[model samples]
Target: MFSIVEAIRQRATPQAVALVQKDRTLSYESLFQQCDALAAMIQQHVPHDPARVDRLRIGVHFPSSLDYVPLALATLAAGACFVPIPDELADEEKRDLATRTGMDAVLVLETLAGWLPEGTQKLGAFSVAEQKVLIQRLPAVTPGFPAAAFEGINPAFIRFSSGTTGKSKGVLLSHESLLERITAANEGLRIGPGDRVLWVLPMAHHFAVSIVLYLYHGATTIIEETHMGEDLLRAGAEQKATVMYGSPVHYRQLVEAPPVGEWTTLRLAVATAAALDAATAEKFRARFGRDLVQGLGIIELGLPVLNLTGAQEAPEAIGLPLSAYECLLKDDTGREPPAGEPGEICLRGKGMFDAYLDPWMPRAEALDAEGWFTTGDLGRRDAAGRVTICGRKKTLINVGGMKVFPEEVERVLDSHPKVQRSLVEARLHPLYGEVPIVRYIASPEGAPTTMELRNHCRAHLAGYKIPLLFSAVPQLPLTASGKLKRA
Candidate 1:
């Protein structure tokens, strides 16, 4: 199979610009050259086993920036799997991810490279895309899943669907899978060589698929460092950006703080990673004259549902699945839901994930008895086949579009001496859609003060995962089987 990088090189014009980050712009030829340089450095510096057929697992820990793009591409081009280390993750959380994925080495920015072990000899520092970065060799450790299983499908990226907790499923996507989904998504997006996308999302979380899509299609990606509304508009105007791919929070910022002038160049603005509020949708349309299309992007399945034709009519709808995808809404009885009624969203598409990395469940085993991959989300379908997400059935909570897992938070709370057991659940908020709240049974000694519990959690969890409210409860609700009741 032709590597995705090779495919990008095939269609791209050498001198045409491919990336714009603030003042720097890289032409297609320059981007490819940098990626090649990094790939060579990775092969030489990062350890590899000639005896093992499995690919090297390379972790990337960096802030939201353009430098991340080349490292990710170079990792993939070198036949290594890319695992992103999100900057928001705490120190312990970062260590957990590295161990869970069995990452061989991590390419980290100068200041962000503190996750390294003590007394290890580090590889020589290298520069890519004119930004200096360090390479640290990790102590050899085995991951939860077998190496052969991961290598079987030619894996490209393995990222957790939510947290890196024991219960969290590590989504494994192959090189072929990335190529397929991006091709399918672009059928509706129609992103091509001429389109420039104004992007603000962190590359670590989004680069594997979204960035690959743009590069594969020969579109220019403009990296606007700030999410500030005025800055985004200025960059869009200066770069002639044709697309805006960001979350609702970013769009709301654009709406609340009106820029001096409108971005007349944008033809499509997609709101993803969270539910798009109608207020932000309508206000953005009124201000910028571009419809805010909402798309459902899941790690298990690459972007399958996008609001292509119905955004102007119903801003809340997730719209129809692409022609290449088949979407099903299943009820509790394991049958299709009634017309215009909510059900658990299930999907089958061209580029579904290969397997769940931890505990080793393949796509065949992960799917429902009828064979569709059931997303733990609830939504309804209209007569015309347009759909909108209504609720979540899983313990995962979306805090301003970032995922916060209840089990991960509960683990931290349970570790405290003052807490015996804890339950975490999502509370609906007008702006954030949902925030995590905790209810716990205090230890026999007595309940800890809310301030004390907050400080205790702060040390272990990210700020977003820190529970919004902590309530002392006599007992947590239990189901008939004695399992903790999850609502």
Candidate 2:
């Protein structure tokens, strides 16, 4: 089985730029050395029971800085699973995660030192001066210990699903699973050396975590402290970034903003986390002279499918499945649906997570037998093998006897000029079982009344498909990964 730590060691070289920030850059060699030093420091101070050492779970609390990378590498190097606690999470949520994961220790930055639970061992931030002191003050631990060996099925990382419907569940990912999934994505996307990537999304999200596959291919990654539109465009030009990935929100801003004609180094742009509207996609392509590849992957299945090179073949499609993944759209009876028939999306592949951690207090059922993970997304495949997502299964609204998909209504609402963003949710109705309601964010200095929105939808949708109520809000509640939360 491949070890993530060993992969880093072999790949590290002085000439390879592994990390870049606003003011500084660290080569692969420096990154590896820092990780090694921190690994030794952790080994020296943390008590390890021989029997439990191999299964140690370590919680990490740090910002997306240079130090965070090495610390994460060191955790894996020390034969432990690293759980990243995003700084934006509430204090109670952080503690709850650490407690639920049964983390042996919490490695925290100085700024978050007080947030850790009592009795948790903390690792101080390693500065140049602190590194020297750690090496001098702490006794040297064994440096040449054999790296942890495991089967291909051994769990590597336990990522929690964004708790949109309920409490979060930990999704266990194995070494071979992640490696194969990422390799397939890298190959399919054609990411390679010399390709500079501007990473602005939160690292905690699987979308950002998938970038590690690019690093393995010798691509350079530039981390941005903030994700403002102008800052991202400026950094892309400054870093000569070739590949950029973000949500539709980011892409909408980029295409709508002032033109940057000279920023031509960008060759590939990817948008995920939510569906990319066709109109917006066309606008982006018209401005950049390059089509934005819309990637289709679920958190439960890692990033097994991509629509990179073949997006233009089917403008409304969500690309083809990755080489390692086998996808099937099945009806309620578990029978395969004919082409163009909408059904639940099912996947069986190496990229699929082993199991979801039980979130209920006493632990509850998470996965079913046969290992076919059912992604609750409703979609259909065309004759040419292109997948077009229709709506979410749980987000369907039942108006009397008719079934209404909120996404269909939301898409129409979003197309309006006065609507900045919109969400369609099912609300309980007295006569009808449930009716669809429209909530939207208005464009700057622009507000459209309920009747205007209704008229806009009436032009595109049937009578039953139209929302019964319209509400305007500044912003809709979203999960950490930016997916719309089901009401």
Candidate 3:
């Protein structure tokens, strides 16, 4: 299979603007040239034999910056696997990932020196020194998993799950999978050369489908470094961005008061990484006159479902499966659920993930005989065929055999003007198997009292589904992808 860099290069023109960050601009031609240069630099440090099965793996430990894009592309272009080590990770977490991936080297800038965990040597080069980047060598360790088998797939990227509800596993993707998913996703997004996408999500979490897709389709990407409402609005307006790809948190903050001025250029806004509450959708529609198209974007499957058909009418739904994918709501017996009933969401499509890295499970083992991958999400489809996510299957609360989807309860609590966000977890109980307890972050105006929250839930939720306790916390934890962490 050909490299992703080759696909991007075929569509690039010397004068075409590919990326914009603040005042800096990178032309498409220059981007490809820089990638090749960096790839050569990395190869000098970690040489390769084209015939070898176990290829080099390089971890990129950079922040969300312009340089990050080129660095990742370079790794893939060099015929090595690209792994992202999120900067938000603690030192121990960082060290654990390095060990788990069996990465030969980590690329870091000199500005962030002396921060990495021990057992790294300097593998410096003149070209890398010019950019203040260091190739930190890691101790060689024999991988417990099948490294040769993993490398046989022409792997391009490896990113770990957030471990939000369970133990995290490294998700692996090959160059071919990336290309296929981008093709499938664009059949819905319809992103073209004229489109300018405004991006605020971290590059580490979003690059596989987002940045790579835009570049492959010859679309310009305007990077908004700051998520501040005013800053985002200013950048979107100044850059004349036509599309916005961000998380639900970014959309919610933009709808808040103090009125960040308008950017009339936006025609489409996609909210992912978390559930988009109905309240935020209505407010965003009123303020921006554009629907917040909620989509289900999993690492395993790129963009299988999008709210293109019912964004305005059924804002809570994640729309239908894309043309290239088939989504199923299967009960425990692996049959379709009763009409209007919820079940575990399963998908059959092209571009599914290749393997689980740490445990070394192949895609053939991950999928069933029918080629369906069971997503842990519990979802229901309406008469219109639009699917709405109920909650995680593992996160469903069992209160004396009564089912409680935490998302259902949290949706009611989030509608309160005085609450920012909340988490509902199962707690032990004498009469019931477990009861839901809420830990929340209150708005600046102060939390509505316990009675107020309970009354609100009572109005919207079933009596059994209402949380038993409400405790305010300074903040809730978020995964590297900017979604709430259930674990």
Best by lDDT: 3
lDDT (tens digit, per residue) of candidate 3 on 1-487: 7788898888777688998888888898888888998888889888886775688889887778676888889998887899988877767777788889888888876766556667778887434315677888888777757867887888999998776766688999999999999999999999998999998988878888899999999999998888987777777778899999888888878887455556898989999878888888999999889999999999999999999989989898898999999999998788988868889999989789999888889999999899999998999989888999999998999999888998889888988999998999899899998999999999999889999998999999889999999999999987655567885
For all predicted structures, in order, the TM-scores are 0.81, 0.86, 0.94
lDDT string for model 1 (248-365, tens) is 8789888877566657889999998766867789998898888899999888888899988888888988998998898988877977887777678999988899998877899999
RMSD of each: 9.8, 5.4, 2.2
lDDT of each: 0.83, 0.70, 0.86
Least lDDT summed over 10 consecutive residues: which range in candidate 2? Answer: 132-141
The model with the greater lDDT, 1 or 3, is 3
Candidate 3: pairs in clash: none
Ranking by TM-score: 3, 2, 1
Error of 2 at 382 (Å): 2.5
Rank by lDDT (best first): 3, 1, 2
TM-score of candidate 1 to 2 decimals: 0.81
